[model samples]
Target: MALSVLAEENILLNQQLATKEEAIRLAGQILVDNRYVEADYIEKMLEREAMTSTFMGNLVAIPHGTDDAKKDVKESGISIIQVPDGVDFGDGNIVKLIIGIAGKGGGHLDILSNIAITVSDIENVENIVAATSAKSILSFFERVN
Candidate 1:
């Protein structure tokens, strides 16, 4: 059976992150804690940010490791963080929702694409950002895609 990508324990709601790096670490740490990725994958996630911003607009940021860091993945999983106040992702981008991804092999594309499609709608993005329960967010994603 395929493992669930977004576990309830991996979702953090109503958080206030001071920096983008802290937000990234918080997101990536969930993956590490859940055994979805090696601890070192968090550092690689930072390196990915240096390469390019993961900001997807509508106050969302998807942080993932670089292509070379795929080896650090143990399984396909995602960590979600809801920052109601929003964290600055630089260049005036304030991200209220953060999705950290650890995909084995080329699975990141599928995860990214699904999220992209779901968040493309402003209503969906708003709903996700305002979600107070992990199950609500998870069910929203499942319903959308």
Candidate 2:
């Protein structure tokens, strides 16, 4: 059976994250808490970030485990954290949305593509950022599926 990639419990809204790492950890923790990934996957996420910034344009960042971290994935899952105040990702990039994902069997690519398409429209990003509840934020991702 396929696990739910994005769940309501995995969506956090109006987070006041202080740093990029904090934001990533918060997202990762949500994944872990939801049993989507093992705790070790969070470290892999950090390692991936060290290799390259996950920050996409239009105030978004998608943090995921590295190729080697695939073993840590229990199932395909995703976590969304909304930092309405914005967090600095480096080089003047401010991210208002942080997406954490753990895909089973190369499923990450599909999830990434869906998110890229959904958030490509700046309006959607704004709507997601301004979402007052986790359910509202989840609706955005649900539509992409």
Q: Superposing all C-alpha atoms, what RMSD in Å does each candidate have to the true structure?
A: 1.8, 2.2
- How many clashes show up in model 2? 0
Name the best candidate (by lDDT): 1
Clashes in model 1: which pairs? none
Top of the candidates by TM-score = 1
After aligning candidate 1 to the native by TM-score, how far in Å is the CA of 86 from where it should be? 0.4
In candidate 2, stretches whose alpha carbon ends up further than 4 angstroms from where it belongs are: 1-4
- List candidate 1 segments past 4 Å from native: 1-3
Q: How accurate is candidate 1 locally (lDDT)?
A: 0.91
Model 1 error, position 12 (Å):
0.2
lDDT of 2: 0.88
